[model samples]
Target: MKQLIKNLCYPLIAVLLFSACGEEDKSISAPEIVGAKLVSFGFYVEDNEGVLDKDYVVDGPIVGSDIEMKIPSKIDKSSLIARFTTSEDNPAVTVKGTVQVSQQTANDFSIPVDFVLTNNSQNNRKYTVRIKRPIEWVKKVRFSEFQLSDAILKVNPVDDVPYVMGITNASNSENRKTVLLKYENETWSMVGDTISNGRPSDIDFTFNSTGTPYVVYTDYTNTIPQTATVQYYDGSSWVVIGRNYNDVRVSYNSICFDAMGKLYVFSMNNAAGGVVGRRLMNISTYNGGSWTTNQTMPGRNYNTYNMRSILKKDILYLGVYDYANDKGTISVYINQNGVWTTLAQGMRMDGATEINYNDLDMDVDNQGNIYIMGLERFDSGYKLVNHKYTASTSSWSIFATPIDLIGNTKYFSIGLNPDGGLSTVYNNLTTNSNSSFVTIDKESQTWTSPFIFPDILNTKADMAFASDGTGYIIYIDASKHLAIWEYIEDNE
Candidate 1:
């Protein structure tokens, strides 16, 4: 790409001469130097702020002085360079400087050079140049199985975070392993790993108001019936808070906390095929010490598949599929006298008839309201349903389900903004195209497409949002490099 350099100089006198690139010419008059500095070296991208390599400092390139500087090329621009300098001073002071730009690919990328210059005046003189280049992301996003993938991006208070914690298998080989991730800084890194056979699944993690980090996931290990475990990180390592050996295979697990910092782990489980006669659906709670297990209400059990579980405040909720009737139902349980009491029975939305609803996803807001997003089937076709749970009366309110997400059946993920609004992302396939996006006003009772991300194609990776309400989509690019896309909201 072409580089535009401004020269900010001092006086009206100016001289234009073209010769092989050389050093700043000290003989240039004060006015020439000031005027030249006026339009110092700069770069820009359409509609974006100029991001010059601020690491470099330039007073001016003397008309005849040779100067060297390193500048970063915008990835979107073709490899090219342009140099220009000005000699303009706002306070009628003489200024002179030289500017140069060059292109460098990833292999030959050069370090930015700093031209240290003095104002030469009794007072300090500051010359500035704004640079802009095409916005570029990392070449590839690398993934490894059997490891945790947590990416902590820069925290901007105004953004609604998408997803923070996710479990992904970096590779698709026979030795595929599960990876647990936690985001801390601007990068997503591995934190914990489970055996390949215990393939990590249905993971939920969150940091309480006190900054205590907690996570829950199901591990399908041979030793114990595939079980759910709770882990907490105390600024150092992940420690298992609770472990069960009841021969109950757990699935579709989630973690949440109440206003009192109590931990709750909700998971769907089935008895050992040979031992227990009936499948068991449960919500387990840990009060920083012991674990208490609670089973779901009658009619909440599904003989064939897993159920999605979530907790808001002190109440527990679950969404299960009725394989027999081909319909989906939600149930809630409340704790009374330290025991979980079934508060509601199979509650179905107005038009929810199909029972084959899978990939059920749920989220809870600050006001103790619960929202669930999942795939639904109908005689005519398949559709998506985003429903809410009003805890005040233990009721279910079916919100608008966007039809655009019909194809994004698997890998469905959701989160909430600090204001209790909802956010969601999933993969959609269209013949040869794939796309994903977050829902608008996620917690609203209404459904509309005010904000939708561009369709992302061919991604076999996990996505997450930061806590500040901004959504970040992470995936491995064609070259296997981690690619990050930030969805930011503007302040009115």
Candidate 2:
């Protein structure tokens, strides 16, 4: 009986030893394995049928250790669910030390997030998931106070709020006066008295660095063979800046401030004794006290249509049209040490040559790249184009996809945004299409589909940037009233 008890004890001990081994963690003896990998990743809509305009459900394969998903503009990124799968069975996925369940966890994906995955064999892998949401630019009105009879002559953007010049005398029956308007407190109101107190013909407005408004204009009612005049806003009243009127029959005139805050006015005056051109193009500069004649531009013959002069990098850029030499060539002159030099030879726009008066606009980027906005003639229709000239290479090329952005336009304005992107304010002459503002980055070849206007036409459309790099589209509306729309980003 004792021998039998001893054998039973040995069997019982064997069972007890096996139970003790089971109590130990099995993972401690786990074998090394090949690393697990991320198989797929996605974010799906809960109520896919009714929540959004369309299903934004994005699910895709993982490439290497990276994953990405693109969403529509204005979509919220703070609260997003990331559903993913792994290659191995019983895999454990964690983000910032928190265990994750497939399609069951919400995360803040405003920026890129990293994830770590572990498989049953204790193998691990890491991945980075990024969400790409395109920016949404919105357009809102900044000014709305205008009478049907009031004519919006020009809009000049200052630091934050802008200033606009208008004609209170819209018709010949009334006494005409140039009025100065200010955009402040979300609306446009009169800042001071009338500018010229006469009927202004050609108008250009700008603000100096010290926040003083200056206007260079031609008044036909007050003076015969109208002279180009400059005016400034002096706290309480609008007064003429310099009394040095050349009286050489100034017609097309513009105003610009130099790097030193000195004001310069360029005008198309009648041919004088020493000046060149069929119409003498004169450059007049104003010292703080008085205005003085600077010099006449060379090679100013046979060019009739005068665009505007813009200063970039302290260099004066003047644009004009030349028909005698080339096929509607756009002549751009840069003042280098007081000598005018031609840039990129001259760009051509065949369609503009046929018209006696055309609206061909020019703007320069911070990089000193010149851009001329005009129309190219085609058998089907006139296609809007932006002819770009690179200052570094001295080469000219048409921007990609202008036809798709503005379609066939009768008039348009092309300007570079502060972010180095190209933007257009175009009159869409397409039968069923509306006017729009399309912005395309310098690197991207295609457009991203932008703001659409309400029945904006071949009316005066100008694109300007505000102090904070915000873009504004200024145009004459259907009622012949001035309209300003600004671009704002919408992030949901």
Candidate 3:
């Protein structure tokens, strides 16, 4: 009886062990997604009838596909949809935050999609889907007989035309004449009369909502003090915005249009020993009629120089070089309900001993984020620094610097691209004679590789993007002629 019971126990134990081994083997053979692909993509346009569907062909990579998609230039990147396929059927795919196979908002300013795939056994893998703007080529054009020394190129947001504003050597007088050229029909035409009113020192150009061009320039008319005046192009002639305020000595001026089409002009007042001296910055506004002195910027000191200001929406951003203190400061002021309030002041490079700021430029994107770029000196070396004012957080922080940026560089300019990214043009000081161009990748917040234009001796180069996603760089070429490097989508 004992032997029979022991045999029964042994067989039961063997059967139980075999069942456990079988379960473990089954669990080890879990399913997995091997591959994925973006099969199709497009955008939806809403009309009175209904939503119109437009599809795009996907002929790019399969492994973490990097696709260069072309759409209508005016289309917003936030409104894009993508359809994808996986190696195995029923694997999950998601984009932008949605777990839908047909995903929308996948191409929001080059943002990568997170494609999460899960197999039958609940095993998962994630693939990144990148949609890039089509590769573009830079086209070069030389302007004959036009010297672009100390000039600026402004592009029309509506028509994509470029206007060149510069000073040319005058044959009649000892003074230089201000020239404005409009690019049309593949040629640059003089807009109006050559400005010979005063010695053109500095100038700024902007446009209103109705596509009207306005300019503010500093002029020294054979007098002891310089005056700044604002004017607009009225189809054929240049019309002055207001009576020239001659008492205040204007050193630098900048112009910008607000959301309501109202124009604002910021001028640096250089008068000495008066109430106006205490208020070194002056602001003027034009609301379709007369120009009015809106408000004056406070916190004035004799050490302030290289004052630059920009108006975005209702916020005014100001950057000034403090020569006396060896520092550079940026400030912000906002207009809320017709009342101006200072948001920030005296924000400078922290813990820097010697600060020499130059070529200060500022721009704002559609999201109300402000970017200010310039050169600053540090213990390591002189480097280009960008300070960003985030609208969402209401804070100021350092944006980014080029990875290869070196010391001894000058001529820093920043502009907002049509896709709401930032573009920067500067001279590489290490090379001394070469100019460099770089852009910020909105998705990654990283600077693109520095595009160095070799032997570009000039200290200034301006960059602007058109409405059709075309980039234009205006610089003085080796021949001292005004040249434009036009960048367009390179389909090939």
Candidate 4:
């Protein structure tokens, strides 16, 4: 009995030892990684999807050039599934599930198998990184001829209030005279003579400080060859400025009232030359009670024909044409410090033979800088031309290159603003299409491309630029209607 008991004790002790050994080997360890999450996408490379660091490795051909994940040998073996989903709206790719092997002691395992990847959906992938392409330039607001009344024939006597006033014909027959139609307080009224029947050379209306009205026009109403008749608005009717005709044989004139309510009129008079057949400028001053006239332009034969006069900052800028040879010439006479001085000249095309009377144009800025635009005969055909005058050096420079901005057309008008910018309106003779508008940046010496008008045969147009650089194009509509198109911003 004692021997049997000893044998049992030994066997029991051996079993206990084996149990202790097994527990030692089963100590708890760090959890094995079973899957990966998509951390982020990498740089733009061909066919690259975002790297997955959290999802289980499902397929053999892992998407990117990098690894998915690894597994520990201690974890229970199961099917590892990885899902690749697209983020954008693409129809070519399909999301599929696959299983991949996770090796123990391996850093990150790549699926050895290869599968076709459609980048059509890869572009759809939402990445934290994105790029935007640059935008191209767009041509907006263009110029068109608004109206070409007989009044606009005298150089540039046309001035529209922009909002309410526009150009209209005084006569409706085969011979139409240009006149100004003004709308004040919602009422349309004729400001100047429609017929200008007596060959009224220049008609200018001015506003008093208190907003009263005054006018100056050349008429033969009182004299035989017709003296320049001056009229003033006394709140109701038109009254002559003085008791007698002050300006006689006035060729061209401009009227303006100063801050003190004083009336001033500058004009060109047919001069008897120390040499004959010359022209001189006569300036008239009027207070509320009296009138006076004096010769303002003193030079002899300075080509004062087709003179355009403007007042800026209490000074007068007279744009005289150099028609001594029939071609166009623009000489700027500036009134400064109580004396008149020749400020600048836009004379680049003077030597060109093809330039004609109808082709000449000129405008003066508030600083007396002259801007001249015209059509020049090029290659036996007329082409658009542009030039500028520098006030400091009294020099002229060509502001347009290639001359295609205004297109190859005839009978166009040029408009200039206080800034050096200019605009041109011309009939697109080829298509007889609507007019084309061209704008030039005198500072940058660049031109925007032609913006074609949308109408057809809107000819005999006139244009004017305002202080804000906004302009008006007045033209006679096809229905014989007066049309005004303006440049405005497009919200779209």
Q: Which candidate number would show the highest TM-score if scored against the true structure?
A: 3
Better structure of 1 and 3 per TM-score: 3
lDDT for each residue of candidate 1 in 127-188, tens digit (9 for 90 to 100): 33223222222223334433433222222223332224544435643343343453434555
Candidate 4 at 137: error in angstroms?
Answer: 18
Q: Per-model C-alpha lDDT, please?
A: 0.48, 0.64, 0.65, 0.50
Give the C-alpha lDDT of model 2: 0.64
Error at 455, model 3, angstroms? 5.8
Which of candidates 1 and 4 is the stronger one according to lDDT?
4
RMSD of 2: 15.8
lDDT of 2 by residue, 412-492 (tens): 676665656777766665534556677774334666565667656556566766545556666666666667676644333
Off by over 4 Å in 1: 1-178, 192-202, 220-222, 258-262, 273-278, 293-326, 332-344, 390-395, 401-408, 419-423, 430-433, 441-455, 458-467, 474-483, 490-492
User: Residue 292 CA error for candidate 1 (Å)?
Assistant: 4.0
Per-residue lDDT value at 83 in model 3: 53
Name the lDDT of candidate 4.
Answer: 0.50
Write the residue-wise lDDT of candidate 4 on 56-131 in tens digits: 3334433443332333222222322233433233223222322222121111212222212234323322111111
Give the Å error, residue 293, model 2.
Answer: 3.5
Sorted on TM-score, best first, the list reads 3, 2, 1, 4
Off by over 4 Å in 4: 1-160, 163-180, 183-214, 242-250, 256-291, 294-296, 359-368, 376-380, 392-394, 402-410, 416-420, 428-434, 441-444, 454-459, 467-469, 478-481
lDDT tens per residue, model 3, 404-426 = 45666657678787677888878
